[model samples]
Target: MKNHVLRPLWVAILLVIALLVARKLYVPADFGINGRNFTYGYYRKASVNDWKEFKVKYKGRQYCKECHEENFDSISKSKHRIIQCENCHGPAIDHPDNPEALEIDRSRGLCLRCHADLPYPGSHRNDLPAIDPEEHNPDKACADCHNPHKPDLEG
Candidate 1:
């Protein structure tokens, strides 16, 4: 009876020891180093080359200003001054070298993300005009009447 109980206990201890040994051998050497978590170290090691090769696609408004000074100037003076170029146009990563115009996102839903009227009081900024998309202009896109660079429908 004693041997039967001891046999299972010994097996359980060995199994735990094997698992610890496997973890030590297989886990990253930098795991949990310098207050970093295990997952961070694991991914950092696994995709080190991917991280190194990663290029920032969104090169900020200043980068766009270098090539599109006219548009930048217009936007600077307009209500959309706070909006970044990459917010409407996709990232300009290889745009300088490749020289292809970015396909503008002209989707109505994109415009409505900010402009759509919400019943929740004071959810949007006071200056930003909100409209019920279905009621405001059922078939028309915002760009149909409003200039994106200078986004005032009346002006």
Candidate 2:
């Protein structure tokens, strides 16, 4: 109870012993808890063998229904059925037998990242069909008048 409470209680016990010796010299020995069913919650047990040796670059939409079954049956019945054929044709992991590594993004800022008009009042992304990106035809390309797999046709 002196040198102003023993100099802030010995500077808070030497700052919790220098943060437990810098968390045992910067924390890594299979970081903690993530085992017996904890999955990726608290990980680094070699991060589940480095996410099972990585390399799974988006093989989904049932692997594009094994070779674009007609653009996966017109994107599984249009309005972009929950959007996926590599989300604007990017990662079909060295795609379409290498259509120049397939990146058909066709910009217009990636279709205004979910069409612009951005109202956002209670948002479920304003029910998605927004436009007005400088009044629609902002110099062409929403696949040149919409045909995102039959997105209400007219292309």
Candidate 3:
């Protein structure tokens, strides 16, 4: 009784697999029904721009703590204390001096650079899922979920 049932199931599975293979081989790239054609375009090479004039230098985090003791004090206690502020927010030499010269960069790309399959320390082994910028807040940034100063602070 078991063999009779199993034999028919195996035969049906093989038949389905054979039909799928045949369908793939016969399908053409173009439908050719409505004179539609599919084309893929490649990117063209371009000359490099001279960005030296716009480039700025970073003076490091120590320079920030001098004036921003409150912010620096909180940040120093977080896991990111090991990480430099300029690493994520860019150079603050101008921003620190004028408070508006430069802006912070808290993009999600910076978080994924280390959090994604790319390369993170063993500490991130239990990392969360990768986020889609379009689906979520494109501007809230990683700081929305995490605080550089209070690493595991509840938001």
- Which candidate achieves the best lDDT against the true structure? 1
The true-structure Cα RMSD of candidate 1 reads 6.1
Which window of 10 residues has the lowest lDDT sum in candidate 3? Answer: 40-49
Alpha carbon deviation, residue 95, candidate 1 (Å): 1.4
TM-score-better candidate, 1 vs 3: 1
Tens-digit per-residue lDDT, 1-155, candidate 2: 56887898999999999999999999998778754555656766786887889897777788878867887987777777788878888788867677698777878897788878789899887988788889877778777767778877553
Candidate 1 lDDT by residue in tens digits, 1-155: 56988999999999999999999999877444445566553344545677888888889999889878999999999988988999888888788777676767999988888888766766554446889888988898778888998787666
The residue-by-residue lDDT of candidate 3 on 26-117, one tens digit each, is 86543233433335332222312344355657877888788778887787776667778778667786684577666677667777665554
**Residue ranges of candidate 1 with Cα displaced over 4 Å:** 1-53, 125-127
Query: How close is every model to the real structure, measured as TM-score?
Result: 0.66, 0.25, 0.46
Alpha-carbon local distance difference test for all models:
0.81, 0.79, 0.66
Global Cα RMSD, each model: 6.1, 15.7, 21.0
Evaluated against the true structure, the overall lDDT of model 3 is 0.66
Angstrom error at residue 71, model 2: 24
**In candidate 1, what residue range of length 10 has the lowest lDDT sum?**
38-47
